[model samples]
Target chain A: MSDTGLNPDMVSSGGASAAPPLSRIQGVDKVFSNGTVALKNLNLDIGRHEFLSLLGPSGCGKSTALRLLAGLGEPSRGEIRWEGGAPATGSATDKGHRDIGFVFQEPTLMPWATVFGNVYLPLKLSGVSKAESVIPVGEALEMVGLTGFEKAYPRELSGGMKMRVSIARALVTRPKLLLMDEPFAALDEITRFKLNNDLLELWRQQNWTVVFVTHSVFESVYLSNRIVVMAARPGRVYEELEVDAPYPRGEDFRTSADYASHCRRASDALHGAINA
Target chain B: MTMSRPDDDEFIPLPGLTPAQKRERIARLVLPGLILGFAVLAWEIGVTVNEVPHYILPAPSLIAETLIKDWGTLYGSLLVTLQITFSALIVATLGGAGLAILFTQSKWVEISFFPFAVILQVTPVIAIAPLILIYVDTVQVALLICAWIVAFFPILSNTTLGLNSADHNLRNLFELYGATRWQTLLHLRLPAAMPYFLGGLKIAGGLSLIGAIVAEFAAGSAGSGSGLAYRILESGYRLNIPRMFAALFMISITGILIFMSFSLLNHVLLRRWHESAIKREN
Candidate 1:
């Protein structure tokens, strides 16, 4: 039930060469129907158990890339394959979908549903009975520190609490892969920083691969072991920088000189991406 | 830094109204009652002062006396109207909701039949009542049909709008999870459309009574087996003006009661989660 033991020392050593790719976007070209080239020749590899951040500006197709990875979208002209074969995507029963836990830019909780119902959704969709899913849903809620708030509606929760419910819903299925798209772009600085720490702690504890898409250089550098800076027009990877900082990253790391330097580098790459 | 624990300062009581809420509740009932009381008192005084003729406009006291004296006959008519109103309302709700669900299933069906529904809605029930009366075996069935036609459109349109108004992000989430059409409609669409459905039901409740009355009026002079509309007509012909006023009073009371019942249903269903139902300090 735990993925923590699968790849414990997954800290990247400034190289994508050591670990086998959990998935690959091989020469992916996504041309939207309206003649927008959202992504072109976007070749990237997802390192197993790696904390990867897709850093880009608004038009950089970072979210598009994450969507493709989550099997919520498809490349117009290239292959997205899993480790052994093509992404085994079908319905909720598919291997590709079951392996992923997606956190959207907005906390897309059902307004009428309770926290428990929202967290129980993925399992319920996969035909797991409510009775069978009770424990996992409870554990997921507890993991997000929302254990007592299970019966609360989304409207009752503040923005951050709603996001936590979204996270709990994502985590309930115990997915191997977690994909997020600007999940914290809407929060205030204090709440964002707090969530950043809580998220990193959860990531460290769970040991699942995370593909976080963000516009914030500071956020990418703080969370990702390797940040893939992307360019805008015909969105493509401009460069990749490994943070090389050790795990158990905390508030101390947030204020450290190395963290600021990494943020500077990531921001510079992002600006170059926006211009190019 | 803070989570919205149930024990937060929001101070929602476990199962009953809080003190402030109870006071607001009292104000809700008392304010409406005060307005009605003031208006009725003014009417009674105004009539007594002007020495208004009983036939033109009966005083409140006179109407009340007539109401008690004629209770046996008027109550029967009121029951008849209530039965038709409720039966029509139920049919409209079921038919409208069922059709809306079908529309969600396929755009073609909606495209094919929506215009016809619009036609039914736009055409006045009085204009259609004659045709309905000719086709149906009984006047009651014709009255019910007329009422259903008037009440059906709001529920259909509101429910359809609500279903279509589902958040794009949530729809994408459902698609991402591979929810089937049935599951999505049943779980997501139905709950999303509830507030809209209830809003429409409130409107339809009043409109159904109006439709029944109009249909009865159109039935005119001959259709006299049951209903307040007929009593009004019969009293008018007999020149029993007080009795006519009594029948009208019962009709008004019934309409208000129907409106209140459905409004209460809406409040109860949406109180916990809906923005409209949530009580704010302001």
Candidate 2:
């Protein structure tokens, strides 16, 4: 019932207009039709402008929680309501007016489409014409270091480059919420680290509420200002550890004693989570 | 900003090719042509030396002579055969791809009609041609129907497989973006199926030609308006073996040309992205 890591000052420090309670996920129970209880009695509030990571072992239902928030799958039982009673627009968009950006585990770019076309997909779905979408897509591509590769097919890209294109596509729409599921787990360590820094840069600049799911403690500590360690066997929230490491964490921070202590704390929490 | 065409990791270029690479490339083409020329020369000489009768096995020279002598008649017949072949292929492609899309749209439609498509595929075109000949008023229409039946199944099955093979994650992403059914079908499934449908089209090209010829053979129509198939039958009945060889040559060349054109189309469409189409160095 108690949140373990709370940095009272950090949320409002970065000029992040991200107010807390971006959404309240209360008592969510997700049971698949074949009867796998992926999540049980989960309650959490996603903070605004926060880079939050759901850290857990495999099968901890971190992805399941992300999926529910993406409006992809409904929980078998529970309620998820936005902080401001949904956006002010009554435009009657197809997806119940919840604007979200989602990144999957795979790069998942359209192989047949060029990078420009792939990034243009979300805008296109919202009925924006190709000519009209050029600026947004281009800006998004530039943000992810994929500006020159707009015409390159997915096959032309290395794994890291493809993932960059994917991230660009997600950010193109400028959604208020971004949900990512283990996006860099497949990349080599160096690429993952580089991407981590770039992603943090983007998060800082954009101030979008991020709910990232990952199995790495080091990653959660490095990127996230808040971490939710979840447990398996009917996956549920185990602890909320606030990574009080100040903003602009860089390579210097990576080798610092503070980073080591944070890693140690997350690892201990994870160890307890797996055992429990 | 300077950019190059996307580099292929699999491709490794050898430093600089001297005369050897040129020679190898030329040999690949010239060797086959030389062998074919040698074979034809041998056959011509063998026939002249052995004094073989024209009906028994006409020399290559005689076939060439007959082809030149009957140029106007043979050319018109070739055109007729080609017209039927192309018409049947177009019909098959449009019908098969359209039905495959409908099948993807509905499980009940696919389940109900798929076995019937299988039945149409397995039953011989020759066996069906006679019945079609009776039922269809025009001989051309009957032959067209026969050709289409044989060519239809490959495109249907291949496109269906392709439509189903869209990346699971990509489909999920599309769903996440709230792409409507029509949007998903148009943007995802159909494009994914393009390579498969093109592959099926290559196979259907050859089959369509064979179907046209076979159906025409089954019909056995002769004289002024007859196709190359009728020319073959007429030559056989009249014991004009040289003319028969000429007509047979035309059919063989036509089939090869059809296959090559489709292969070219597949290469053009897919070489940029598809793994099967892209050239690998390793």
Interface alpha-carbon RMSD, every candidate: 5.0, 6.5
Clashing pairs in model 2, backbone N/Cα/C closer than 3 A: A5-A242
Question: Best TM-score goes to which candidate?
Answer: 1
TM-score of predicted model 2?
A: 0.90
Candidate 1 chain A: worst 10 consecutive residues by lDDT?
A: A1-10
lDDT to native, each model: 0.82, 0.84
Q: Report the error of model 1 at residue A142, Å.
A: 1.7
* Model 2 regions more than 4 Å off: A1-20, A86-98, B1-28, B221-225
Q: Name the regions of candidate 1 deviating beyond 4 angstroms.
A: A1-17, A86-97, B1-22
TM-score of 1: 0.92
Give the alpha carbon lDDT tens digit for every residue of B1-282 in model 2: 111122321222223546876798799889999999999999999999999999999999999999999999999999999998999999999999999999999999999999999999999999998899889888888889999999999999999999999998888888787788888999999999999999999999999999999999999853234899999999999999999999999999999999989988998888777888654446
lDDT measured at residue A220 in model 2 versus the true structure, 0 to 100: 95
TM-score of chain B of each: 0.90, 0.90
Candidate 1: C-alpha lDDT: 0.82
